[model samples]
Target: MADDTSGLSVPPKKLSHSELKEYAPGLQPRKMTAKYEKQKETLLRDRKSIQQLHKQRVHRGQSAATQKYESRMERKKIDREKKLYPRNREWKDADYFIDQYLKREAQMKTERVRARKIQNVEVKGNDEVMFVARVAADFECSPKVQKIFRELRLYKPYTAVFLRRSGENLKKLALVRRQIRVVKPIRQQVEDLIRTRGFAKVDKQRVALSSNQVIEERFGEHGFVCIEDLADTLMKGDEEKFNLVTHFMWPFKIDEAFNDQSNKVPGVGRSAADSGRHLQDKVEQFPFRFMDSLMEQACRRGKSRHWMGPELIKALPSKKEAKFLMKVKRKKVALKAKERKIQAKFDAIAETDRKVARKLRREHKQQREEKKAAALASKNKSWKVAMKKSAKAKEKKEAKRRGEDRRLIAMYGKKKSTAKKRPPKKQSKVE
Candidate 1:
């Protein structure tokens, strides 16, 4: 207790902990102001970070120890699978499912084949892969064949796909095999194909394999060391790697002009190989020409393998061509102008002739009218003379009988003169 100035007893004010801490070094309460909103923002930011942490923990939580070891292992495996490939977030879910389904089916097929081998049952599958080029589009075929085409990705004409010669594949292929030309491309042809028409799929876009460097960069270290290796592998590599090699390449699209080329050259190698294999007891082969056929085959083979230097490009007319055309058009225009000028000159001459003819016609008409008038005047003059003579004779006879002229009468019944029309008055001048 302490005494105040007025002599009344007073108690000393106690210092609160917060007030003491505020006065202490490096410890003070926050300043309050309406302008500052950083505190609330900081709180909100902390809340969001905490929520993220909680979600992470929940998503990555471990299995309980009380759970069975098998169940925990299964749960961990499911979590790993979900993390590795989230089904909900995938766009190609059906493709994944199909892949899994195919893998399972392949396993089953192997098991069945094993059982059949043990039981001495027959099995069918081909090891060789052939280059199948679609020459004709036959959507009008039955739905089964259309489905096969869809699977093979050979719906477009002049496009080719690599197809394994499995029994099932061949059976499906034979249904429409005539429309497709299947041939085993040689090493040279394979290299030529990759060199000329090789394209790679990058991010679902077709990128042209412009050089050997591009091919090496893309497919090195895995299977192919260089473009040559890839081409050779595609041609005569292990049959197992055939599908894998083909997957790197886009379907080959032969130009329309080269559509039937594979068809023609398919027998070139085979015919050459078996030409002398059997010379006798085959058929009555007379004068079998070889040079022409060989040359044609060689030409076709060259054209089929290599691409031309540059495609035909259409362009606007050049300055020289345009100038020549302009000169031609100018000549035509000048000829037309000269023709019009000649026509105009001829028209002027015709007009002058027409004017002269018209003037002569008018003069002749006037002369005819004048001649008629003169003849009528002469006849009228003669008639009038006869009439006057008769009238005078009669008048003389009457005069001889009467001998006195009648008295003249004065003008008394004449009409009065009418008023003349007045002339229009002119406008007065402005002041």
Candidate 2:
């Protein structure tokens, strides 16, 4: 019988330190050899059994769950199909449906007609000429506006009518006699016509059209008629005629006329003063007013004192002064040509320098990239070497630890076997 006051018994040890070293160098001190080995084997077998049982349970649960889910999903699919394909009549009345359908059709037809009308209107005035005509009508009505209409009629084959601003009152003019002539610049002509009629009198409304009217009318199809015929008719008597002639000849500048002494000509009398002043005025306003007349007279007299071009230049005086002026002009042109050549050379040198700088910058950038790659490669190689060394050290340490663990286990096994064979300890009674 066991004593009630006694403590639990410990297993006996068999192997000593030297004995363990001779028999099994792997064994540790103070361990039960046999019991430890037995316990280790039992623990390993239990672990494998538990793993197998857990795996079987998981597989059974997954199979049952999947079968249940599939059955539920099949029932739901059948119910959804039944709902989508109903056999009963959901709408029993046909009269209301037909009326709604017909109403929608009528609405669509009306919309289609409206869309077609809009498309037709867009196509009708798609040309640029029509577009310009519409834009011109937006501005105030003037002679210039009429002139634009005339030009549009002359150039475009399409017939366009201008509408007056008095609420859609459109006027369709006849294009049967439309003709365009490149008259001398009409602005200058208007200015001359106004100036020759006396600026003060013209400003005072002596002329039927003011300078602005004359300018605006020049652009008009019939405005030039008022300028040529109306203006000539309005100027009556000698004073008015003289003032008109002078104004026409000296439109902008009155100072360009020669002095009275310079106006003297061979066999010319006092009566010719008026004619001379008119001729002087025409000369002062040359190219602006009577360019064609000047060109013709210059051609006839063999004197190139005209405003035309080289033909007129040749007709100028063949004196020493004129020759000297031509030489000076030639010298200035030659100097300009030399300056342009020097500028070209400087531009070429600058372009070459820019290209060379760009090339050097590209090479420097490439060198930087190579250097960075070299550094990164060196770093990677060093890291790989360090990792290999660390792995080898870890393996060595693990082998040493495994050897120690085996020694401890073997010693424990031996001690356990010895303990099982030892005689039981005598116990005292505690009655």
RMSD of each: 31.4, 42.3
Candidate 1's residue-wise lDDT over 1-431, tens digit each? Answer: 66444443342477676765644534456676755677788889999999999988776664343356778889999998876776766365786779767765764564444333323422254455467765444432345445667788776655677666554554455345334555555667667677677787777888888766766676776657666887777656676567677877888775422333332222112232232222211212311111221112222335422211011101123468769989998998999899999999999999999999999999999999999999999999999999999999999999866643232213344455698889999999999
Q: What's the lDDT for residue 105 in model 1?
A: 71
Worst 10 residues of 2 by lDDT: 124-133
Candidate 1 Cα deviation (angstroms), residue 303: 27
Q: Give the TM-score of candidate 1.
A: 0.31
* TM-score of every prediction relative to native: 0.31, 0.31
Best by lDDT: 1
Off by over 4 Å in 2: 1-237, 241-318, 414-431
Show how many residue pairs clash in every candidate, following the order shown. 0, 20
Candidate 1 versus truth, CA RMSD in Å, comes to 31.4
